[model samples]
Target: MKRTAAALAALSAIVLTSGLVPQAKAEEKKPYKIYLSNNFVGNDWRQQMLRIADTVVKKAPLAGRVDLKVENVETTTQAQINSLNNIIRTKPDAILIDVGSPTALNPTIEKACAAGILVITFDQVATADCAYKVESDWSMLPAVQAEWIAEKIGGKGKVFVDRGLAGAPISEQLQSGFEKVLKNYPGIEIVGYFNGNYALGPEQEGVASLLAAHPQVDAILTQGYGSGAIKALQDAGRPLVPVAGGGYNTASLVCAQTEGAQCILETNPAYLSAEALKLAVDILDGKEAKEKHVFVYGPFLSTDPQPSKLYPDVKMQKIEVGTNAFPDLAPGLSLPITPDWVEITPQEAAGS
Candidate 1:
């Protein structure tokens, strides 16, 4: 009996000493319940963002760690608020929002925070102090591209600026960035402004209308796909010029293929959802963020090698076929598809 007891005790001590107990405990930890609340799904960017989030939760690091539920509401502040109210009742471990209005969701977000639910807003983030924000640095997107345009056009040219979507905070922010950079270059003249609304049809129409009015446009600073501007210039029989726009796959491909086209495409990556998911898991696992606002700055894609003085630290990669820009993919697909942590193929990103 003494020998048997001694052997059992020895075996138990070996298991504990070998760290097997802790490892088993860690493996047994339950996955966190996370909810993604999105307001709009009208554009390719928003759709891609949702797809990326779905892909992320099924991959490693997040695959077994998160039980993610996506709740997409109508493109209205009130609709999102209503959806959030229902989400709050479920009391998931965390709630991630892509806000329709920055401040309109504050009251609802506060209610979520009050109930001890972690709230994280990304992309079009909210203004709730209690909710953490993970978003692209909007100021950099326009500033770097604007600086490149000023240099490409030799600091003097008639430039058309896209005002983006009406009444959107990001639109104003981008417009502000563009103006702030161009103000330094006295020779550069912003002759026309249009509402691109971040859609191809509106962007093309807006640019075409501007082209008809301004006979001497030297460059275009578009807030959406640069392809629309290219098509507008082509249809108007005007010479292809330098353009600064968003990093859409078609835009980069068009810039590369079109002769005499000088372009800079900035990315607001869809992987931000993945980032938010990771952050929620980290916080749930007892890791605290140093700051409430987590700023993710994407790469500056250029058709030609045009370095920036304003943003020296930013990654500026030359757009290439089958690399940064895929020719076989959908036009509306966002570029730089995969985040660094995971390997999401272009097919997966494009939902092919």
Candidate 2:
């Protein structure tokens, strides 16, 4: 009887030990090596990019199952091309390139793919081929901004575009959207000129030259900070110009509150990163996807009668892009599309 009881106890212990070992092995998942290639680092957008990297690392289900290698190559196209080439030699499982032109980066992407490395795109999308594409429809910003302006300016005004670079995708797509909206309201006269250098100096100079070209500029519509237009307006004693921009941010919040600018729209960038990371992980996990262009999302729209309310403490503007456009994810590092704007009202400016 004593031997039988001892044997039963030993058998139970063995089963328990075996179960725990498998559990421990499952918990101690292997790490995944992911390479991230960043194209531009000096802009406000890039700050969000870094935040996205951090968010993905913290939020991914695989957690320790993934490792990151990040590299930024200023804004030079050649630098991006070279840096990506070098990273490819390391043969990471996946790489995300925040690019400006898809075609220019296509050859390199092809080589990386040939090496069995999955590639994805974010931010300034390259014209190159990749496994996934994540970003807001850049083509939509121009029309979206124009739509907001048309609503504000009552569908008729002489507006000048402080656009992005002449032929750049951002500039081109935004311009196309704006043009589409313009056709709807022929009363809205486009006082053309000004490129989005995405730099303060070029942005400012572009607006300055624009003011010179079109003295009767009713309102200035731009892509970046819109600092140039504002400076030109203020320096020239131009009372107020109703301007709308996509990169609506804290400074824009301050400027809007002080009646420096008008409507500012912000599309949260973290969503882009999270989406890009999600896809990258999927590809790494040996899953097969049918398409390459995987669009994550864009911004949310927040409108406060007084843009000043955002001063001191800013929060994500709840965008009304509809709930159906989202995917299911757990709490914590969940990225929401808060791409809305709080317009500095005409009354606010009038008082200022």
Q: Pick the candidate with the highest TM-score.
A: 1
Local accuracy of candidate 2 as per-residue lDDT tens digits, 39-97? 76655456555655654565436466578888878677788889988999898888887
Regions of model 2 farther than 4 Å from truth: 1-23, 59-62, 127-130, 259-261, 264-271, 286-292, 298-352
Please give the distance, in angstroms, between residue 255's alpha carbon in candidate 2 and its true position after superposition: 5.4
TM-score for each candidate, following the candidate numbering? 0.92, 0.74
Model 1: residues with Cα > 4 Å off, grouped in runs: 1-26
True-vs-predicted CA distance for residue 285, candidate 2, Å: 3.0
The 10 consecutive residues of candidate 2 with the worst lDDT sum are 324-333
lDDT of each: 0.90, 0.62
